[model samples]
Target: MSNTPSPTPLAPRRTVVAIAAILALGALAAVLILRSGTPGGSGAEAAHGHGHSEAAGHADGEHHGAAASAHAHDEAHADGEHHEGGGAPAARKSEAGHDEDEGLIAMDAQRMETAGIRLAEAGPATVRSVLQLPGEIRFNEDRTAHVVPRVAGVAESVAANLGQNVKKGQLLAVLSSAAVSEQRSELLAAQKRLSLARTTYAREKQLWEEKVSAEQDYLQARQALGEAEIAVSNAQQKLAATGASAGGAGGLNRFELRAPFDGVVVEKHLAVGEAVQDTTQVFTISDLRSVWAEMRVAAPDLPAVRVGEKATVRATAFDSSATGEVAYVGALIGQDTRTAPARITLPNPDGVWRPGLFVNVELTASSRQAALAVATSAIQRMEGQQAVVFVPVQGGFRARPVRVGRSDAKATEVLEGLQPGQPYVAEGSFVLKAELGKASAEHTH
Candidate 1:
């Protein structure tokens, strides 16, 4: 009490309150210590619970950031997929001459039409394997002739002109021949002698019958008549050989050159006042109703170019053509050029197939049925092979790899990789090939 400041009755009450307050604080501290000692209510458990909540929030934030980054990266990649807005594929060079477009090409109808690209459907067709042979037009030798004068003569007049048509036995030219004149003179003399002999023989016969002459005299007169008759017959034959008949006796030396057959005068060597010999060919006439197309085939193709095979003859000068069968084929190859000769007899009803005109002969080697076919001009080279065809797609075309079989000038056969009635590019497919090449080149860079 002496050391402490509280000694009155109010001090005792304050001391009591202080001691009560100290006891209550200590009791609360003890209760807290007990709770900390228990396993279920430990202070570390509380701290660990708070740490778990913070870690969970941090993990969620990191996951959201990673998802955003992944989405952005994928968006930068392939943009060309056949979906909304028609996204395209990634650009990449292909070793097979194809781009990453998967053999697809896009174009509008107007643009395709302007590029001269025509579309058609592939269908069943006949593929004719034709062999093209070099050839020329020639005269039909079977109906041609070379006219030669039978007797030596001087041309008096030319009745037929070059390129003039003439009928059989028509006069082509007239000639005055000395040999003919001599023959005619001999014939006239023989006729005169025959007349005199006939008169003598008649008188002798009358004398013999009436006892006016001896039997020997009558026989001699008869023999003379026979001799004169023989001489006249010989003279007539000699004059008849020169294509001349004794018509009017005024000009007996006249020789007429007549056309051996109906033909056109293709050549004329003799003119007015021109000297011609018996062996000289003075005129040439050819029947142009038909002509021959002589084709020169290689030795290897000789077998295919046989007689009776169908052939097409096309003129090089004009847009003219004709169909005929091969008439003749040479058995032996030419010694100089090593080519076998074949011929086609073409009917020239209009006389249009002139001689010396160049021509081409198409011989059908074989024919076959095609499952799918298109125009030959539509074939394009792709991946170093000429077996590519452009097929129609939505708003575009595709380069389809195909197996090609036989081919001809007009059409090609598709062995595989195509279907009948599928539309494809029939003409101007080269433009698509060019565009594909450009695309490939750009991809390479």
Candidate 2:
């Protein structure tokens, strides 16, 4: 304060005012530089052309402070206009991208045909409600038989083999048995006595008529002949019971087992020299022209599975199926399984079905008319959607999400998201689904 003269209040005020003015000028120049260097400067310049012209006219008359203020206002207005123009095109682009992402799969007519895409109109259809039950293929009991020898004997010869086809009355095996031999011997002895008895009766009748002998003596001869005849008849019946012929060229004990019907020998338990019992099952024969598809029906499904209803039998181990009628349904349920046994009679003329082969039985529980339906094959599963159907749009096909109801092998009922008369891809729709998936992956990348 001693070395320099005291500054005046007016000088300080003037200095502060000059500094403020310089700062305002510097700020305005910086704003102009920034706007000119940016990419949007051209569009900003055109939009603010009128402001620039008016500013030019006032530049000479306005003070530095006012000019800086006006330039700042113009810079802000230009920036606002630039931002608006930039956002408009961006908004339009975003709208287009959204439309493209709405499950649209672009395809040309030629490409669609090449991919085997076929279309069908959705309309009223009958939807069959099918009840599926587990089952197993079994022998047709009505045409199957278990063969046994009536008398216990050692197997002399076994002519039939496992899996051999035979005709009715075909000799299966020959056995030699003491039991049969005894019965046959009795018949032969009785027959010889019967022959003698007939001669005696003829002589006795002649004597009685001619009075060559006493009446009591002739009566005794006649009684003896009658007793002989009775013994022969009883002996013949005994031989018949043992399945032995009264007079045959073979040994007296030779017993032959014959097939009761035309069938295939599915089982054989006897072999040459093997001793067997009367009750032992020796052979199992079955006529495989028909087979049984047997299943266990639960209490709830018993009503739907009735005699004479049509059912479809499908093999579980292989691709085979047949349609048949429900032949039998048990009147009582099993105490352990709490289910009733049901059977379907399938004509197996080709002999494709075999016993013990597991299968599935499909029965039509009911049927109803659906207002709108599509082929079950037409339905496809997509991410975030339960099911979708491909329908034609302007540029290509669009995947329309659908709510499905009852479904069978042929048709599926549509509960929503479809209309009658609307055309949709029925066959080869899987091709379209694959295409859609590929498009989504590409877009994601």
Using lDDT, give the best candidate's number.
Answer: 2
Question: Please, what is the TM-score per model?
Answer: 0.62, 0.79
Clashes in predicted model 1: 4
Could you give candidate 2's per-residue lDDT for residues 1-445 as a string of tens digits? 3788776656455445444444444455455556466664564454355444444444444445555775676677578668976898999999998887667888898998899999999998999999999999999999999998989899999999999999999999998888888888887888888899889888988988998878887888888888889999999898777666787558877889999899999999999999988788999999999999999999999999999999999999999999999999999999999999999999999899999999999999999999999999999999876799999998889989999999999999999999999999999899999998998898789
Candidate 1 has a TM-score of 0.62
Candidate 2 deviant stretches above 4 angstroms: 1-91, 94-98, 206-230
For model 1, residues 1-445, the per-residue Cα lDDT tens digits are 3676865565454444444333333333344444455654455455445434433443433434433443443343323222422422322223333533555677898989899999999998899989998789998899899899889989999999999999999988889888888888898899999999999999999999999789999999999999999999998988778777765344877888899999899998988999988999999999999989997888888878887988999998999999999999888888999987788999998998999999989998888988788899989988777579998887688888888889998899988878888889998899999888877788679
| Per-structure clash totals for the candidates | 4, 0
The stretch of ten residues in a row with the least summed lDDT in candidate 1 is: 76-85
Clashing pairs in 1: 80-87, 80-88, 80-89, 81-87
lDDT of each: 0.80, 0.86
